[model samples]
Target: MKIIVIGATGRVGAQVVTKLASDKENEVFAGARTPENVPNASNVKAFKIDLHDTKDTILSELPDADALIFTAGSGGKDLLQVDLNGAVKVMIEAAKKGIDRFVMLSSRDSLTPDSFSGPNPSPLANYLIAKHFADLWLIKATNFDYTILQPTALTEKPGSGKVTLGSYSSNENSISNVAAVLAAIVQDDSTIGKIIEMSDGDMAVDDALKNLI
Candidate 1:
């Protein structure tokens, strides 16, 4: 299977690239604005993709693939440009290119703009609002078989390959664990059209996902 991972140079995105590349049958195309930072490997290839570029340019850079995983963000810098509109642009391009599978890395409470907690009267509010609409647009407006993974409080802890899904998202979610789940979801068609909120838990990752069915 071939997969394109946006934000490939990012923390969770990098782990997803390496994890996907570990599978001999899988080929990973890593997309980043700064392509040089993407890791070099046999099954992994870097491509130039700037979310801030023209929509046509983004489409041109994105290669033909079986799936797309969107984890790109501006770290609260350019919320509208890089987070909301940027994501929608990629989705539009993916649809134009006939790419049907999509996976998004969103945050906890993104579905509820009011409940989302961040610094009082800060970008966090707008970030959640952006995510709220992005996820809604994917679900309501697009025909793609999409999976939206909403996790909370990403951490740097070692991955235990354990997680809780379907329940509300809350925990110190390790970036590794989140990446692993993102990797696994791309290969599982059952996850299509599902919105999964997850976090650290005692159940194995695979097991937790199976419970979703």
Candidate 2:
């Protein structure tokens, strides 16, 4: 598989890119706004990409990719620009290019529509709303293979080398554990079209997803 990872410089995206690139079965394109921050992977090439660009940075960097994984997110200033519109831009480009597999790294807050209806949510909540819209757009945008991984309260917990995948639950997971889940989803064909919510668990990432429909 030829995979492209947006936000490859992020805390979790770095792990995902490195894991995929090390697999002999996959080749990786690591895209970041600052290429220097992207980790060096043996089978990966780094590219500088601004998701906020109108010209479609993802399209330009990964024109022939088989799978596109979006991990980029805007924290405070402009959630509408980076998370919503930026993600939409990539989805549009994916549809135009016929990319088959799309994986999105979303937040657990996206599972609840009321996340934005609270009494003046924090800036981070608004960011989650943007991510929610991105997931919705991808779901409605194409018939190609897709999966959304929603994780809660990310921690720095060392990936217990395991995870639990299902619908939105009250369970929480660490960033490393979530990274493990992303790695599994990218390599598994059976996980396509599933919105999987995950948490730290006793089963390995691959095993947790093995029985996932």
lDDT of 1 by residue, 49-161 (tens): 99899999998999999999998998888888888899999999999988989999998778875566545643467788888888998999899999999998889999888
lDDT of 1 at 68: 97
lDDT string, candidate 2, 87-182, tens digits: 888888877788888999997768577777778764467777788788888898677699999887777767677676775343667777777788
Error of 2 at 211 (Å): 2.7
Compute each candidate's TM-score over C-alphas: 0.94, 0.90
| Top candidate (TM-score) | 1
lDDT of 2 at 164: 69
TM-score of 2: 0.90
Q: Which ranges of candidate 2 are over 4 A from the true structure?
A: 56-58, 118-124, 167-171
Instruction: Report every candidate's CA lDDT.
Output: 0.90, 0.80
Output the number of the lDDT-best candidate: 1
